[model samples]
Target: MGAVRVVLVGGHESADGADLAPVVQQLPEAAVSTPGRSLLSQVRAALAGSDAPVVVLPMTWGRDPVMIAETARTLRWVAGGDAHGRVALSEPFGTTDHLIALLRTAATRTATRWPGSGLVVSAPRASPFDDAELHRVAHLVRVHGAGLEIGVACVGEPADLTLAVDRVRALRPGHVAVVPAGFATACPEADALADVDFVGPLMTTSAVLRVVRERTAGALHDLGHGHDGIAAGLDADHGHGYAHSHGPDGDHTHTHGDHAHAHAPHAPHPDPHATSHASALG
Candidate 1:
C-alpha cells in the first residue's frame, strides 16, 4: 500500500512550519500548509497523479470556517470536482471541549499556587461561533472545575485590555490569574494590566502534538474503511466558487460568486466531535 500523505493546515497567521517541525518529522509523509495560495499549491502537489490516501488535519482549537472552507475548495479545484474517496479532512486538532479541559487543568494549578487569585481566560477574537464556543468553554470551566472566580475576555472584543482587567478585578480575588485559550501567548498588553498573573498558552506541550496524532490516526482509519470524511462535506458545503483575501491581522473576507449550493458551513453532519466519519458525507 502507498503511504498516506498528511497535510497539517493552520490559520493564516499561525506559526510557520518551524513550529510544526516536530509533527512533520514524526509523520513519515507530512507537510504543513496555511490557507489561500499556500494551501492551494500544497493540495495540488499532494494530489498530483496519485490515488494514494491523504489526510488533512486542521491545526486549530475550535471551529475555523475560513481554513475549513478553503481546504474544501482547494481539494475540489485539484480534483476537478469533489475530492475522491481516498482523501480525508479530519476534525480540527482540538475543540472547545479541549480548551475547557486545558483551562480546567490550568485553573487547578493556578488555584494551588496563587490560592486566592481569580482566573481570567483570554482568547483571540475569532468568528461568532468560535467566540461563542470560547464563552461556553469558560462557563463550563467556571461552573464545574474552577474553585477561583473565573472570567473570560477576548483580545480584540468590544472591550479593551484595561476594561477587561477591570472586569476581572471586580471579582475581587487576591490577584488576577490570566490564562490564554486557543493560542499560545497572552496579548502583548497583558503585562500592562495591574496585578495580573499570566498562566499559559499550552501550544508547545506534548498534549497538543498528541491531539494532532490522534486526529490524523482517526482520519487514516476512516480512509482505510472507505469513508471520505469531512472533505466531502466541505466540498458539498462550498459548491459555489469563492475567493478569499486575508487581512494583516489574519482576518479573512470571502468573495463568493455564482452560488449553486446552500451556504452551510456548519451544516456538515457527523462533525469532528462525532465518533464516526462514515455518515458525514451523506
Candidate 2:
C-alpha cells in the first residue's frame, strides 16, 4: 500500500520553533495543521492528489477539548462538510492516561535527583476537568512514592505556578522541581521562582515520537483495509460533558449525550501561497 500522508494538528504554540519542530523532522511525510491558521488549506492540499488517507494526530495531552473539537470541525470542513472519510483524526498524541504515566516517571527522576524535594506538575489552564486531572495525577504520583509530596498548578488559573509552589513549599521539602505537562516548553514563569528546578517539556521526548509514529501507522493500515480507524470512534464519542469558564462571560456547560453548541466563526482560508506560510499551524 502507498504511504498515507500524516498531518499533525498541534496546539496554538505548536508552530513555535522549540515545540513541534524536532518531532516533525523525525517523522516522514508528516505536516502540521493548527486551528485558525491554514488547517483547512493544508489538509485540503494533503488530500488533493493522494488517494491514500491523511491521518491527523492531535498534539494534545487530552486536557484541551476545545482543540480537539476545533480540529474535528476543520477536518469535516476539509472533507467538504461531510464526515472525514478521506481525512481522518487519529488518537491524540498523548492522552490523560499517557500524561499520568509520563509524569510518574518524571516525578521519580525528580525525587531521585533531589531527595525529599516536593514535586509540582503544571500545565496551561484548560478546564475544571483538566485541573482535577492534574490533581489526580499528583495524587497518584505521591501514592506511588514517586516523590516526597506533589502539588498541582495551572499556568493561567487561580492555582498559578507561584501559588502551587507555595503550596508545595508549605511542606518544607529539601528543594522543589516544577515539571511541566501538556507541551514541549517549560512554563515561561518558572524562572521567576527562586531555587526551584524546572523540567523540560515531554513533547520533545522519544516516547512522544514513538506514539506519533504508532498512531500514524495504525491509521494508515486502517485506511488501506477500508476501516476508518480512530476517527470512526471519535465521531461516535465526540460528545464531551464539561464546563469551561469564559472570562467574564461566566461558565458555559455541556452535558453528555447528544449536545449542540456553536463555535466562533473562523475566517475563510486564504490563497495558496499565504496558506503555505501561515504560522499558527499548517
Candidate 3:
C-alpha cells in the first residue's frame, strides 16, 4: 500500500488563493492546485513531505480537452519523473448530473420574474469539445425550463457574449440569465444589459461541493480497484450527464437532469504539447 494525495485543480483566478474552502476542508490530504507554476509548486510542496500517488480533480464545468494535455506536459517537464504515468486526473467538475441541476437551480431562481427568458451559459472561451458539452447541457436546461422561453448561448471565444445576448434580446424576452459555466471565480456585480440578469457562479452551492468530493472519492476508489488503464475514461461518455437512480452511495434515485440528447464521441488524444490544456477526466 502507498500514500494517496488529492489535488483539486482549478482555473486561473482573480485572487491568489482559491475560493474552494468547502473542497479543501473536506479532505486533509486534499489541497487546491492549479495548472502551470502553481501546480508545480503544489506538487513540490506535497512531495517534500512524502512520495505519494497523486490524483487531480479539475474544478470546472464543460470539459476542455486542450487544458488536460497541457497540464500533463507541464507535469512531465517539471517533476521529471513518472508524473504523467503515475499521476491520475479525475473528470472535470461540470460533467456530472449534480451541476446540471445547480445551473438549473440558479438560472431558474433568477429567471422566475420574466415572462420570456433566455438561459445563457458563460465560460472563458469555446472549443470543439467544450462547445459540444455546452450544447448538451443547454438541452437539459430547455427540458427543465418548460415554462420559460429558454434559449442556449455561449460566451467568450468562437462566439461573443454580446452576440448570444443579442440573440436572446432579439426575442425580446422579459429577461435573460447570464449563468456562468465555471464553478467559482471573480464575477461582475451586475449585467450590462438592463434586461439581462446574472445568475452568478455555482461555487457557493452544495451541489458543487458534492461533485468535487465525487471526483476525488471516485479517483480514490478506482486507485483502490487498481488502475485498469487511466481514470481519464470518465470524460468519454460523461459529456452529456448520466441517468443513475442514486448518488455515489446509491442511496436515492436521481432523475432530475436526465435527457435524451446524444453527444459526439470523445475527442481523440492529441500530442503531448497541446494548446488547450483544459481537460475533464483525462
Per-model CA lDDT versus the true structure: 0.64, 0.64, 0.55
Predicted candidate 2 versus true structure: per-residue lDDT over 78-174, tens digit per residue: 6544335676667666555566667777888887788788888876665665566667667876787564788888667534888888888898645
Top model number, lDDT: 2
Q: Give me the displacement of residue 102 in model 2, in angstroms.
A: 1.3
Error of 1 at 142 (Å): 1.1
* Model 2: lDDT of residue 145: 57
Report the number of backbone clashes for model 1. 0
Candidate 2: Cα lDDT at 8? 79
| Model 3, span 234-256: residue lDDT tens | 22333233333333443432121
lDDT of 2 at 74: 61
* Residue 260 displacement in candidate 3 (angstroms): 32
lDDT, model 3: 0.55
